[model samples]
Target: MLRGSAETEAKLRFQQASGPIMAKGVEDTAFYTYQRFIACNEVGGDPDRFGVSVDSFHAYNAHKQLEWPVAMLATSTHDTKRSEDVRARLAVLSEMPDAWTRAVQRWSEMSQTYRKPSVDRSIEYHIYQNLVGAWPIDAERLQRYLEKAMREAKVFSSWTRVDEAYESAVQDFGKGLLTDQRFTADLSAFVDSINRAGEENALAQKLLALTSPGVPDIYQGTETYDYSLTDPDNRRPVDHAAHAALLDEAAKADRKTILNRWNSGLPKLWLVVQALRTRQEFPECFDDRATYEPLPSHGERLITFVRGSKASKKRVLVIATRLRRSGVTDTVVALPEGEWRDALGQRAKVQGTVKLDGLCAGLPVALLTSS
Candidate 1:
């Protein structure tokens, strides 16, 4: 009757019923179960999309230039479920799901005694991974975070109707398990392994955000390692004095050495400052209409590309890796015909064919300018 409605009352009834259905149809169409990847679960992003190929990324950039040139390139936001670094760490697990499953089992066995009867195994797995990715977390902080997560999950507790008993049980589990000496030690060791590989992923993405075609936004205190969770954790105060002191120290040192050490997120901060400086100095190179050229790479791991007007003589070549721990073993990227100086590094030059093993001796990615 509503579908065939021609009468005024029938048409009005159909409109009222269909409005919410249509609206919810779009809303519910987003990534649901696929959010397990988590890295792609950002606002307006499809979590089901595993990873973008280098070729697709270039195509996306080209489209961005033609259409949404003023898009904001971002990784973290106050409303994000997990911090960028946490997602970066978890992204590695996608490539090693079997290992992740085994680790989850081991962790569950290691901490099962502390869990309350109400605790769900799936939620436990989720909590364990979040803890590992966001390690160095103090007990008090972790408990508060867990409490919030529990309420948000609304399985045992909820924000509106307080399930005090269930909330307390979850808190007890966090307090008991997270505080155990042996558990902490094992957790730290596990986090160290993930960080070893995760840091490489972090660096690659950071470089892309800075050099890719779009206006990049650096959230507060994000220049450093941001392994933060949602809300209060991500919104924590920044020690500007400390960061300023680090920036001063970095200014005196060469970019290459800073990147090699990558100690205390100095390398990331340096990259930001250098890239922003370049953008500020050469607006034409990053113009909304600038041509995006994807450079060919002989290596399977490298993603190389150039951006800017070829006639302008001011161009930027960006080269980043896709994998972690692979390092520079037998990797080579084809370069444009000209002498290019490292824009981010101190003193590195390359022409024609560039060898990653030689160029990035200790670094994971590099940005270069034609000389």
Candidate 2:
């Protein structure tokens, strides 16, 4: 799997094998095995489950162990089962089984009258029929359908079948009337539920994996938002030219202020650049013996942690927020009672107990370090 562009083959092999093996002094053979097991369990019977739980477990565990100084964590990969947001929302189903079951029933009820079976109509076929025939579809069956769809979508495009890719695409569009309505309604509800549970679990897990003991790796555009989905879609090349243009524009004006005004995605790009700079400047902090401290905030939208090297013991503070808007907040840190600088803004000295008001407003993360 590591040799190929897709990790499916490796993931499958890792799951099928028994026990664990040693790989490059990093016990990954065992880690992969456990991860697959957990992933399978997390989505027992949901079409959108897609093993995100397993991915998260692997990331967190890998970070806990100092073996992989940097670990690449992702819910959406080229071979992922579903889109990241879709899977993230699906994970919420585990929290509200009854709601998930009832929603699936409604979706099936609404989709049963289609002329031709919906595209990729294997399990959904049975689900729709069962819902209409039985009046009330079995929750277990609905769950199974969700699991099957998630797995199958990984190998087959929902809009393309064996010899009927074009035909399926047409049918998909035709069915859009009903499918779109039902899907959007159900998915919106699911997203709302997930947001209520707090969007921090996934984000926090990613950051912990990134800055903790392991080698932190980022999946192309994931630093900004979750774009979970399978290959072709996930593998789509980033528009570096477009991004470069935005960067240039922002740089010409007040980079930070311009970024704050732009609603597109310049802020995210800026944050990624800042994170990269932080990693480059303070290699020692991420190397070993770093401490983690969660700050107290009113909204629970901000996450702050500090890492430092053991030798020089220089500390770098990271302040990350999940809020959609910008605001100020107070954070307490155990720095050496001296002036600290904001690395992203050219070593601007920050007073005691810094206020992160406009630091990363509208941005996903803010990387700060001591001078």
Candidate 3:
């Protein structure tokens, strides 16, 4: 108050304090507190609400296109509780709530022997959700994330006020899961069984992020499937050299080859590279002035839309799947009369009413452009 004035002092104080308060409250504290479904515990996400309708999604995108056309559209980031692909895998759980409930119950029973005093049901539930979301995770990585999560929850343990015993017990219980043969095997079996479905969702998500109304932000290592958690974990460095090699190999690989090897993450990289290239070559289709219209599909399973204007040289069509597999849409969209080519992976051409099965050709999503 001595330097400037009371008003200036108050303004400076608010500016200094507001940033950390909201970040700690919303991004760290509240996100962990409302961990009903751990997948939705992402930054700016709600755990209770499952998902939005196709109509709602289009409306939101339309609004974004009109208002904030150049804003960065990001799915995963440093602040995300879990990476995009992690959420994609966990999303599969929503489709199988009954089985997931039973699995979580059995896992809790199995961990009873190892779980510590402070590791209550709530803690166990959050841990199980992470286990399912980030499968094939190493003991060390999961332990690190578990510690971060426990601290963030601020329930029994936290960063500011250290609770060594509680955190150690939780970490030990998490490590015990790897040692428990039955638990690991069951987790592996279930994760492997539904992996394809998760991949389908991941592909659809990746496509939409890249081709949707706003500019896509491909986080490091997310050009492929990334199952990371928030902060220091998600901040791990990417192997750009290896990714460069995959991009080279993707050119020669056929659609089935890429789709079949989902674990290699080639399909996602392929989609990203192709989509970006299309956006680069035909900038008009994705620019601010471009028109966005939802294409009519028979069912609610498909997210279908096209972008372009009468003045633009090319029109881009984006078809992505949701809540279902690729083969569900054997024949769905009836395109506008023109010569259309799959601008993404798998070079395919068609005109008039086209089967999504043939357009995507067994792939979960498709991006087409008028020639």
- Whose TM-score is greatest here? 3
- Pairs of residues at least 3 apart in sequence or in different chains that clash in candidate 1: none
TM-score of 1: 0.87
Which sections of candidate 1 miss by over 4 Å? 1-35, 297-300, 326-328, 346-348
User: Local distance difference test, per candidate?
Assistant: 0.73, 0.46, 0.83
- CA RMSD of each candidate after superposition: 4.3, 10.8, 2.8
Model 2: lDDT to the true structure: 0.46
Candidate with best lDDT: 3
The CA lDDT at 244 in model 1 is: 96
Q: Residue by residue across 33-61, what tens digits does model 2's lDDT show?
A: 22221222221223234434333533444
10 residues in a row with least lDDT, candidate 1:
26-35
Return the lDDT, model 2, position 262: 44
Which 10-residue window in model 3 sums to the lowest lDDT? 323-332
Candidate 3 C-alpha lDDT tens digits along 1-371: 44668888888999999999988887787777665787877667766677988998999988988998888999988778889998999888888888888898888888888987877778788788888878888898888888888898898888899899998888899999988999999999989977888988998999899888888998889988898887778999999999999989887777778867878989888888888888997788787888888887556788999888657568988898877732475656788779888776566676788777777776778888885
Worst 10 residues of 2 by lDDT: 24-33
